[model samples]
Target chain A: MAKTITQEFTKGLWDEIPPFRLVLGLCPVLAVTKSVENGLGMGVAVVFVLVCSNMLVSLLRNIIPSKVRIACFIVIIATFVIVVELLMQAYAYPLFLKLGIFIPLIVVNCVVLGRAEAFAYKNGPVRSIVDGFGIGIGFTISLTALGALREVFGSGTFFGMSVFGPSFQPFTFMVEAPGAFVCLGLMLSLMNLAGNK
Target chain B: MVDNNMVDTNKFIVSHAPFWHDGSKISTRNYNIALAALPAILLGIIFYGMPAVGVISLSISSAIIWEFVFRRVTKRSNTIGDGSAAIIGMLFGMLLPATAPWWLVILGTFVAVVIGKQIYGGIGANPFNPVVVAIAILMISWKDLFDFNEALMNYDFDFAMVYPLAALKHFGVSAVDSFNAGDLLMGKQSGGIGSTFGLGLIAGGIYLIIRGIIRWEIALSFLAGVFITALIFNMTDSARYAGPVIHLFAGYTLIGAFFLATEDSSSPVNFIPMLIYGVGAGFLTVLIRNIGVYVDGVIFAILIMNLTSPLLDKIKPKAIGKAA
Candidate 1:
């Protein structure tokens, strides 16, 4: 039983990543992913929502009306999202501004809702919490990877710090939409190739 | 309508047999794509004036030449007659700055035709869109040349010895002030030969959709992604980044999103994947412009999506129980 719980907890980190593997939570993955800072912030918010919602849903699995379970799950998810929004505005003001509409938009992130329906409602609270943590970490890692790559190449910076020497000229396209695709494509391909091994 | 004079019927069948036999089909809509590019061609002549005309012609001609050379080198049957290479060349030329040197335009065509389109066994065989691939290469290698603001400042209606980015880079942000949004819309500003007439590209894109040469989802999603992302950024700090409308209307985005990125071979065939592809491209374009080094992101977004086409296709609606 303990071994099974460990498997669920670790699965989302790589074996079932919300973004790179399952391809969920793409809006934020593409939207707030211009820099590593934004990616890290969103990633944390996702983990918060995922863990809270998953744990709550798992605790109430037997009680939720099957027909309206989805509706009930959404309400729970939305409550967490609102809390996250308030926290970001109050504390992480700069990041809140950077993330902008995306923080509110997290209410619709397929990853949170997906776990609520697929894993949380079926499993116990402890297992669901583990699953949420794993998936959220996986998402954060992928988004950070793509964000760092685009920031460094496109702008010659990393987390707003210029890494390129004085004479270094930036490949401006790297920060643009085209660069996002190129970097993500190469990363996805590399990820896929590595996973194949 | 099927002219025997166009080809020895046997050679046409044999040469095209691989595409047909391999179950990769070509559609008449591809020809309509050529038709869609007509307005862009006319607009190229209007903006950046005669110099734009030279770049357009050079791109189309060089694309044809390179297609022939690539086919000959690979010992494959010549497929340039299908008008696809010509379309790519015309689009490539249209995307280039009117003030660009002839050699640069020719080089861009070579990349689009040979390295981009033909290198992966020609046409449908390539993973990424050829035009986007060529534009990306040029944007990276000749970073200075792709700067619209710089090009506009240096050329100032004089095409001679104009290297636009040099002026912008040297004079700083002050040089960019001369080319405002109004001039950019009206085609008076220095920009890619045909894309300067933002209205013309939009009009042409609409025509292609009406003619069924292209679908609206990919184009709309791309525009939507750029608009939404830019809007959020602009709302937060309007002083730094341009608003969503400016990001949408500026540069070659309309042309690139509608005509170039929506190419059948490079985009996913299914609606869902295509929607994801468009949104992804749009998101990337905005991210790049705001934080990236380049002002354009359409080509890069399209190429990246093209690379992911196969994987996106794999995520089909769940089949009802095939196996355990």
Candidate 2:
């Protein structure tokens, strides 16, 4: 019943894409997906946190007692989240500023904790790393896709550059909070449809 | 006695209560609603010229087309014949300025049908009125489009070109003096294409009410709520708030009471709940108009009340059962 190495990596891409398939970690998905810059930035940060946390959790799986596994997982995830927060602040100050509390919020992201409790805690370090990377990439793709869709239509721009001519009236509704919910719902349904096929 | 040739129609017809259908159809209701709206649309066309016709026709066609295409794609049974899509389109068009861009109309219909109606399982299954949802989104996106003064500036009528609500909102109560009860009643006010003709809307509402298409309780109570609330606001400060009659005649108030607020699925079925929902919406409408940021509050108020409809529907008649 064990998945091959490649299977482990690829499952996260489509089969368990975070926001679309697993529907995990929606706070960053909805809040940070206002633009491609914010989305991709947040995605990279999560990728780092998920990968490092998974690696650490897998390494300590044997030593960590089963009674406090969740607490231990949180401790490990929070460490990596801080590491991500610092790295982003040093190298990507503007993005860190834009992402604000959400960067630290990654510590409690159910996706990270879920992977630790469900996968890393049971799997070898190598497989856990691969799983985390795969899932992280899937999360990134979804965030970026949602961000692109929202930005292009909502602002008549892509990555802050104009997509349409000057006369193009932006559908500003797509940028609002309600618009985020609508966009997320639509993307979820589309992923469902494609998966069914 | 069992003849092999006998069809046994009554035997198969044994089913749930209310077996008599009253010869009514979904198509009949939808078409009747559209027909009732015709007078207002005609007056809008008369006032706004061919642009009005174009917006309306395009909205209706595109909405139906969207519904049809969505059904085909989803492989559901074709429901475009039900005329719900047409009614949604018609209502959406009725809420727009005659000068609305072609793309806006198409996008609005797409929202109304695909996102609003079909995505919510279509027609009566939608939690909110599809047209109201569409208009609310459009209003949020392109606030300038619904600005009657800017949108209808070119048209030269003998009366003022100011939108009463906008005038009141922006320039205080004095700026709206030109829009008296007579002019507003005569459909001389500047507003959405089909929403300004007060006479036509009342007649249409009355016709629908008499025909039992829309519940009279909701419509009458909604108007009474508007009148009472606006009267109270006016009495508190006559110089600040407009009178009750003007509030009733202007913006989406009349159309909303008759059409939008009385939408079947989103409204309550029980009598007391219907009155409460109606009054709550009317009160919110005035409250928002007098104090909120939006120039017109009818759609938002109705939408807010629509959120409470399911809970309100709990206030229903107790069934005769062995256990409470």
Candidate 3:
């Protein structure tokens, strides 16, 4: 039984990663992942929201009615998202500004609400927390990787520091909106190829 | 054994559709295209000097190399023998200025071969013209590189150094009067390396049409569309818009009508769709030249038309045996 629970936790990390596997919560993935810093900030905020919302939803699962479950899930998720938004505004204002509407937009992010309905509502508190951590961390890794790739290629910088020689002409396209889609698509294809092998 | 052999000979052979041999291969078509483009290319080389040769050669070799390497990596059959890469290289090089840098040529060919063609499954599978895709990306990325006036700044010409399109764009129609109709036709004006050779382009276009390599309908309708649209615009405001003749002779008008707009994979196949597609591209080219940000609208115009090719191809005439 414990092994099965552990499987549920680890599955989100690779077996069912949010962005690459399930393709959930692409709004934040595509929106704020222009730089490593922004991606990290967004990732941590999502983690906080996911873990909290998942736990709370699991705790109240027995008491909550099945018919209005989606509304309940939304309220719970929105509360956490607001909390993350305010905390970021207070503590990390630069990142808060960078993230812009996406922080508030996380209220509707499918990942959080998806976890609440799909896993947390049926699972116990501890398992739900584990699942949230796994999924959140998975999302963080993917976002950070995408950010790093775009940043290094687009600007010849990683984390705002020059990684390439001065002669290196930045690919500039990788950081633009079209570049975002192309980068994500190539990454998805690479992941599929790797997974198949 | 003899009885078995006789029985095997009597069995019908199962083969895929297109059993009839037309003797048309990709290599034959590509080689013909290369031949068709030679006049403009030679004219460009004569006018632009050694740099034109360098850009053209590098672009061709690099495109072929990129395609070869991609096929090797993907474990697909080598398609470099078909000469499509060379044609793409030639077309892309024609669109570039003689002053184009080596790095820009390499980058453009890489984009044309790898990103534009191979990534979409190569050759006939690509929805867009590989050269147009590369040129569009390059234009967007490095606007100054493609700016004929800026790129050709070093050269001291006997005539005005100003590219006619740029002159028309910035200084109204009267500014283009400096470029005589005869000179523009003879390729004395400044523009893209091969595109400026209006007479050569027309001859090459005519040759391709005669050989039946490209449909006469597309080339004619495209030019007609441009002529009619430019004439309308010229009539509306003679002071602002250049005449249809000037529009035809200058910029990428001639080359685009012949080569870029008729790329097989990205263009319509049927009769009505071909006319509509060609006309639409020609009309859009004039519209963009008049109003859009880009100086020459041919690249974007053809790309826009390429997007509509699938939809235009859907406009088929009724089949003869269909239920009434």
> All models: lDDT?
0.75, 0.89, 0.86
The best candidate by lDDT is 2
Q: Per-residue lDDT of B150-244 in model 3, one digit per residue for the tens?
A: 99888786878778998899988888887887899888888788888888888888888887778788888889889999999999999888989
Residues A14-50, candidate 3: write the lDDT tens digits: 8889999999999889878899999999999999999
How good is the docking of model 1, by CAPRI class? incorrect
Ranked candidates (TM-score, high to low): 2, 3, 1
lDDT (C-alpha) at residue B305 in model 2: 92
Best prediction by TM-score: 2
Pairs with steric clashes in candidate 3? none
Model 1 misplaced regions, further than 4 Å: A1-197, B1-30, B154-185, B319-324
lDDT of 1 by residue, A103-192 (tens): 989899999999999989999899899999989889898889878887776677888898987655565666666556656655665567
Q: How accurate locally is residue B59 in candidate 3, as Cα lDDT from 0 to 100? A: 91
Q: Which regions in candidate 3 have their CA more than 4 angstroms from the true location?
A: A1-10, A163-169, B1-22
The CAPRI classification for model 3 reads as acceptable
Chain A TM-scores of each predicted structure, in the order given, are 0.95, 0.98, 0.96
lDDT (tens digit, per residue) of candidate 2 on B87-183: 9999899999999999999999999898988887666667888889999999999999999999998999887777899999988888887777878
Candidate 2, residues A1-197, lDDT tens digits: the string is 87999999999999999999889999989998999888899889889999999999999999999999988999888888899888888998998999999999998899999999999999999999999999999999999999999999999999889989799999999989899999999888877877786
Query: After aligning candidate 3 to the native by TM-score, how far in Å is the CA of A31 from where it should be?
Result: 2.5
lDDT string, candidate 1, B237-274, tens digits: 76666667656766667787788778866777667887
